[model samples]
Target: MNKFRDKLSTRNTAETGVRYEWYALQRCAATYYREFEKPKIIWGNLATRASFTYDEKDHFFINAPACMLPTSSKFILGVLNSNLISYFLKSICAERQGGFIEQKPVYISQVPIKKPTLSEEEKIIKLVNKILLLNKRINEIGDKKTSESARIEQEINKNDEQIDEIVYNLYGLNKKEIAIIKDSLMK
Candidate 1:
């Protein structure tokens, strides 16, 4: 914890425009968030460039800001990890000189969040939960490679694909649009 504290600066983050003390508030504790390196390459390289978990021990994230939501983390994570959101982000976010999209607070706050119906929410949450579970298993599996490891990997892949499908449906993207997204992601 001392190592994390030592890196703190006197200045507030330009993107967030809030002082570090704000994060100390109780409301900010249960947060999970991710960061994107650049705007331009976000859609081109990865569908979602987000961190999976937060260090609850520290109670705050440094360098990378945590996102707080009234809804389930899995629901938000599913959207953040989707290619559809990537396309949305690229269309609106500011591009950095390094040809990357700056996923700062100001830009990310502008993302068009769809108010999913209860059934939609349930579907997304279920897929995200499965993905998280498989990811946990994969992380826990060190050098011990068993048939189980492969099975976990397969489940992860399948869940990821399902999440993509759900995201596409949520955004009402047709096959052609999804195809374009797929083609762009391939590049």
Candidate 2:
């Protein structure tokens, strides 16, 4: 065990550009949240659906599911928020009376991800960024312009649909599989 510990690499991480030893005392603590770069994805420990979002803050998470994914890309955000992954997670997570699902780190680790090519990743990031901007604009507009807010929401919806399509293509899911996922979501 000592030999293995000695062999552990102490290096910088691409995700945050922060260096740390494999067995750092801080990382081994009960909180389990490690140092992550800003603009990283964060989601609740429990959710009825895939509810992941990006935050530009350095935080010590409390009451949050812990997962160490070295993702600092908006493409990852797009994939997580897509209907495909949502459907996959909903099917696997334990359900409660009010449709609450226990989206613990254990199940999250089991998610099947197809690493995108450079071009594909860029495309997804572009679309996801557009959706993010539209959402921000909606929030900024507030109730001042209900019509403008509605228009921005429609734009967001369109981008979300595009994202789902892109995700489906990424996984090579056929018509039947897509239909099944769509049906499950409607239920």
Candidate 3:
């Protein structure tokens, strides 16, 4: 994602470029919200509740959850807004479009922030890392289960083949007879 971010800043603005910017903005908004907001909300909610505007030819957006006000938590709101500005200044400035710009402000809900101390931030970071690690372990276990199931299926198939060979030998059936019997069983 960092590599993509690097590429995004250097790329030319076309249709794909616009799409990339849209995606990057969405991700940046979500990240900023999560990093600053309390009890992190869903990305869909953030996207739906927030919007962008062109400020003096500069594209900017306020990302907030519904039913919140920027005035409600001015400090956190300022932080989030600043983060958005920095992300754009650093990443999205190169993708700015030409004409057809509007100066109206895009009203999105204000993000709510729980003013956490440094210790709280550290705790949150540790918790988030633990959750991520657990999720990764769960994914690995799921993959291993899938692989084991496939291995068992293959073993069963081999056992069936051995059983069929034993039955053919017991019945004194020739290769052609065994083939006919196998075809009939398949049908």
Candidate 4:
């Protein structure tokens, strides 16, 4: 890989022929993550809503237009996917047409995270894991129109609501702030 590294951007490689051994990736992130697997949160860079997802596989080669959170914490996933975080991101992130917000890392990083106690964090992780399992089952079921899929989705929604409540309480948000969070999502 070292021999081919300099050749990549040089005129020599263009003439001699390309070596497929080189990792086709960004200059910095490529070399480091090649040998390691760490859980990361992947979220759509441009989406109609907050869609922060936990990267269970821990494969670092996520494609373009997604923001990466450099942590494996399911508790963080629970907080990120909550309505409160979604509302927070939407308020600050740049909005494009079609209601999609530009969830650039610069903006995503600004979303505050309030650390909960170990037990509370564990509770959130459990809920997040439940949602992950439900999501997995839905994927296994494949067809979205099936009763099984619907049931799993309903459970996921319930889990999401629970996470949101937990996050709201953790942040000590007022009813008025909660109302604003809820209302901003409406339109």
Candidate 3 local lDDT, 22-111, one digit each (tens): 235444343233333443222212221122211122223364432322222322322333223222222222222431111112322222
lDDT of 1 by residue, 1-187 (tens): 4455634543335645555653252323222233222111121222133323312222333434443332335677777768876676767666655445656556556767687888888898898778767777788996688899989888877887888898788889999999998887665
| Ranking, TM-score, top scorer first | 4, 2, 1, 3
Which has the greatest lDDT?
4
Each model's TM-score, in the order given? Answer: 0.61, 0.75, 0.23, 0.81
Model 3: per-residue Cα lDDT at residue 171: 37
**What RMSD, rounded to one decimal, does every model reach?**
9.5, 7.6, 25.9, 5.5
Supply the TM-score for candidate 2.
0.75
Residue 21 accuracy (lDDT) in model 4: 40
Which candidate would rank higher by TM-score, 3 or 4? 4
Candidate 3 runs further than 4 Å off: 1-109, 143-187
Q: Which stretches of candidate 4 lie over 4 Å from their true place?
A: 1-26, 60-63
Candidate 2 stretches greater than 4 Å from native: 1-37, 63-70, 143-145
Residues 1-187 of candidate 4: C-alpha lDDT, one tens digit per residue: 6776666545334443543345564444534553336677888789888888877575555556766777888888888888898888888999899988899989988988897988779889999999988988988888758987888899999999888888989999899999988888888
lDDT against the true structure, each candidate: 0.61, 0.78, 0.37, 0.80
Give a tens-digit lDDT track for model 2, residues 4-28.
Answer: 6755554325544555677654533
Better of 1 and 4 by TM-score: 4
Error of 3 at 159 (Å): 46
The stretch of ten residues in a row with the least summed lDDT in candidate 1 is 38-47
